[model samples]
Target: MRKYRHLFRILYLILLLFVFVNLLLGFYGYAFTPLLWNPWLYLGAVTVFCHIWYRFYRNHAPNWQNLVSVLLSLFAMAILVFFIELFFSFDGHDLVTIHSEYYIKEKTIVFQRGSLLDAYDEYHELVNPFVMKKKIKKKVYID
Candidate 1:
């Protein structure tokens, strides 16, 4: 572990630098130009490269601490990518709501904000359309 520790440290630093550079480019509207646009793909490639370095050069299993660090860094990069995508999806809209969990669950990117609600409540009114449209009242039961 001590023999290749310095080399691994350098690789980790390079990974951090790469993510930072790409984040800057992404914010400047150059996300999907050359590389570093797709966070998952780039980060996955970097992880694989790190894994190969550990397997071949170190000739041993990777350290858990190093793996966890790399994964967390990659997660931060993914969040940056999500923010970039969300920024671009808006087109001078009055209201914008981002549902990231839904995007992760379903492989579909929802660009338009709740069209019905946004159209109806343009001034950001806290109106529940369902309650307004429906006449169903809550049953009160006491036991």
Candidate 2:
């Protein structure tokens, strides 16, 4: 257990670093848009990484402590992200609702819910609907 401890420790540290960077990116904005990180995404990635680590790593088996730590961290990240969204939005609700669709003919995206948020691109990239509409108009006019 002692010999294999360092391996797990390194992985744990790397996971922490990844989470920290992701949070910062989400808070400030990602790819020129204010995007919130989804905790489930991180959780899935961590679980997959750990499974791979356990499979090929010598005689070392899965450790409950490691699993617990990872889950706890993920939960913490989820809560932090939830709060961050609240902090940014004027209302006490989510900054953006996750559901939306785009109409090519109208060149508009309509958000089903939330006053400030409206449709995202096909890639699920969120942007100000006003900006998106303007871009669509420009594109149509130029063509």
Candidate 3:
């Protein structure tokens, strides 16, 4: 068991690094957006990581160092979750309600539950709906 301590430490560090990277990508927008949006996935990963840490340390006598490490790990996880929630709060409704539609012109149209309509071109650039409506009208008249 003592020989495996190094392995456990490596695994713990890897998990922490992964969580940090996930948080950074979440802030960067749409990079692992689906993963960030899923609270259950984050919760499960945190739970497993903490459980492994606890199980590993349980075999040894309690020490201040172990306790402090556990506390710091938990604190980091809490901060990560808080920031993610804060990010969601900024556009919570848009995330839950907006749906995207793809058009033949290689445009992606996003519809919000309310009155607003947003369109994005193939390059992911926002296109004014009024301009698109006029273009569609012209195409109809020409045909």
Candidate 4:
């Protein structure tokens, strides 16, 4: 049983990696924006929990360091991640809501929707329906 302790430790290390990456994905997914980080979408809680576990292992051990590591690691990761977002990343919510670009041939490209009212709002804000409307003038009687 003792020889397998090494095997168990190795497995624990692998698990830690999985958790860390999963958390990064989770945080980034929820973020769903372009930056040096934050993948630009909503990531689930499972992602966060898994990442917590991974970083938990890196700084802690079989000893009683888990509690201390968990607290500080979470704080550090949160601050670092948030700071990166604040200083570097775009507002993902905005990106997800509305976007526009022009092609060389004079066509504009726009995407406005998660398939809901928010989509319509984005379209209006970005696409300019008034400009897109057809123009016509009613004839008036001449005196």
Worst 10-residue lDDT window for candidate 4 reads 130-139
How do the residues 38-135 of candidate 1 rate in per-residue lDDT, one tens digit apiece? 44344545665565556654554567876786678667766766675555343222112222221211222222333333421111111131001111
Off by over 4 Å in 4: 1-49, 52-63, 89-143
Clashes of each: 0, 0, 0, 7
Q: Can you tell me which runs of candidate 3 are displaced by over 4 Å?
A: 1-46, 58-61, 92-143
The local lDDT score (0 to 100) that residue 39 gets in candidate 1 is: 48
Q: Rate the local accuracy (lDDT) of all candidates.
A: 0.40, 0.42, 0.44, 0.36
lDDT of 2 by residue, 36-120 (tens): 2234344545555555555545445558876686578667766765565454332312223222122322434432222444422
Q: Pick the winner on TM-score between candidates 1 and 4.
A: 4
Which residue ranges in model 2 land beyond 4 Å of their true spot? 1-61, 91-143
RMSD of model 3 against the true structure = 12.4
Give the top-scoring candidate (TM-score). 3
Q: Residue-wise lDDT of candidate 4 within 1-143, one digit each (tens)?
A: 44445655665565465446545544543211121112322132234544557555665565557666666766776675556444322222422221222111122222222322322211111123212211111212222
State the lDDT of candidate 3 residue by residue for 1-143, as single tens digits: 65466665776676566557645544544222232334444555576666678676767788899889878888887777666654543342322211222232334232211212432222121233211211111111111
lDDT of 2 at 72: 80
What candidate 1 gets wrong by more than 4 Å, as runs, is 1-61, 92-143
Per-model TM against the reference: 0.27, 0.29, 0.32, 0.28
**Judged by lDDT relative to the true structure, which candidate is superior, 2 or 3?**
3
Sort order, TM-score high to low: 3, 2, 4, 1
